[model samples]
Target: MKKLQILAGLYLLCSSSTWAVEPVVSAANIQEIRLSLDSVWVVLGGILVFFMQAGFALIESGSVRSKNTINVLMKNYMDACLGGLVFWLIGFGLMFGVNQTGWIGTSYFAPNEMDGWHWNLLFFQMMFAATATTIASGAMAERIHFVAYIVSAAVVSGLIYPIFGAWAWGSLFDGEGWLKALGFIDFAGSTVVHSIGGWVALAGIIVLGPRLGRFGRNGQVHYLAGHNLPLVALGGFILWLAWFGFNAASTVKAEVSIGRIALNTHLAACASAVVYMVYTLIRGKAILMRGTINASLGGLVAITAGCATMSPLFAVMSGAFAGILVSILPVLMEKLRLDDVVDAVTVHGFCGAWGTLAAGLFFEGRMFNSEIIAVQILGIMAAFIWGFGVAFIVFKVLDKVLGGLRVSKQHEQRGLDYTEHAELSYPEFQHDVTFETDDMTKRH
Candidate 1:
């Protein structure tokens, strides 16, 4: 009986010991697990955003004439490589470092010693900086000097993008931005990323002037058809897929709300695409492949700011409006004598502004709050002023310093692929074909 009593006592002691230790061990491990999960999600999000570079490259290459295909591809590639390097060295600091009077980041330049979490966030943001820089690559595709474009990309990635980003997103790190303090709600950078990119692209095209024959002496608009519709469609699909990560991962946490965000994104894109096709039909025109693709993208940009906060119905409405904007803005650009190769300004700039306003106008449970709408308008104006104004000045200075931002007439006629890079996307085709000074070649 005494032996039995002793065995029971030992059993209880062992069980009690495990109960005590298990809670302590499990608590520590649960914290670690949460950290690991969050880190993985963030890294995955960065990877998805990085893949967007491929989409940009394919879309831009296909949108340009075959003669300039190689040059466009090269520029997009460098936008990620060279632009990423500059953002890492300087932009990251100016964007996410300690706040300096609610205007800029003051530390973390060329960061090397940040903790793992900070590093992950930096990687994600670096991809965003590269994205903003690449928007101009499409708009400035054919005429821009390769060297000049490279310099501009570095400046934008390292300075303009990050500085504005600091004003709106400084609190992401150790800083606080005035926009955030004013309760501006650009949840996923419709203004900070897309509008900023679009504005810079507008400045670039304005400085570079229209491509030869884009506008006639009598102001007639000429069409510059893309060489490869298949590539354009593929790129659009890829962007659509990657955008799930773009909107959902902005949460930076593994949470239930991601499902809603993803659904909203999908619905908005679909609504915009359908609306674009119908609008084209109503205009007595066949649905254009490029217009449809761009309309979907515009919708995605429009809903990005409000995806988290908007009901799916409102998401659809915002996307439909963006589709209308996509349909009409190209006409306006042509009327204004602007030659935007891929309509980057309309898709990203105007759509981004609309999305920001929608974020407030459609805020769940706080719909049409006047103060919020005003704040959104202020953010939109700030983006245009800083993004377009500074970029215009910088491009003008570069144009003067570099002699000009566009290629020589002869070089432009021969095609940038041959003149700029001594390479050809279609080597089988002869390069001696004469291009008209006032119109694109029949083959194009």
Candidate 2:
């Protein structure tokens, strides 16, 4: 009887202890857990997107000549550092601040007080601002003065990108964007990010002019092949992996829908790559590695706006069209005497517009709603005007105020790595060669 009583007492004590510690499954508890999970997901996505800076560095460095490799890498590095700082100081507020007018954000500049969710959102968006600024880096590679490039990056991150972003994504906070109010759906910023970058790149290249010797006096185009194709390929793969987070994380939730978004993103990229490869083969041209890599990126950009809303079949269709566009737009750019070193204008600018259109064209169950497409078109036009027109004026002013945007012709012939940075990417290979007075000898 005594043993039985002792055992019963112990069991009751344990039960009472468990009851005391057990979590109550209340709505508040569940909501808190949901918030935590979503915050974590957004942070992870931001980290992935941040890694894209390395991808850009590799791609831009490999695309330029050996002499200019270090210069390209430096620009990409500064873009992340400087661009992130400016976005935090000014851009974030202008993009996500509370406003009644909706033209721009009126608060949140250099935000100091915010909850965990706001911090996570700012971190994620800072990566996007860096990305938009870096797009102009590759297009202006080899010739742009380092100081000028840095200034341009700051302006874009702090002003141009944020203002346009406010007009489209302002509702992310307390303000409502005019475009968003019109039912313009950019699930992941095809126009707001990529197209804006592309437009800035277009403006930059127009002001900088083509690299010397890129076009002969007779108007024949000379191809300046990338020094390291393998690096370009590797960079392409990195960007490909990063894009999943780029598109899916825009949902800002840890939900089942991320699976579908990721699947659509993958399908679009693969379809576009295959289509570009096949097109090259059918045309009897050698399979160009860079073209195919860019084709995949074009598709990724195209699907970003619609990844959340698009079905797999339509994703493929959008990617296929992007492949075609990527194939032809480079040729068109060359014909126009506009020199884009990495074809950033076509891959990001034109393809981003197409992707924005695809979002409306393939909206599930509402395919090709005229009103939605019209809204999308309006958004596209606004991005172009704001992004390109403003950037053009900025670059032109910078060009004159800074003395020149391009390096001296003498410095250009000697390679920017030596003239700009006093460093050489392949110094060991140049021990036997001597730079002549005329600077005519090409540094291999």
User: Which is the leading candidate under lDDT?
Assistant: 2
> lDDT per residue, candidate 1, 254-293, as tens digits?
8899999999999998999999999889889989899999
lDDT of 1: 0.90
Alpha-carbon RMSD of each model: 4.3, 3.8
lDDT of 2 by residue, 49-69 (tens): 998889888888999888889
Error of 1 at 368 (Å): 0.4
* Model 2: worst 10 consecutive residues (lDDT sum): 431-440
Q: Please give the TM-score that candidate 1 achieves against the real structure.
A: 0.93
Candidate lDDT (C-alpha), each: 0.90, 0.91
> How many clashing pairs per prediction, in order?
0, 0
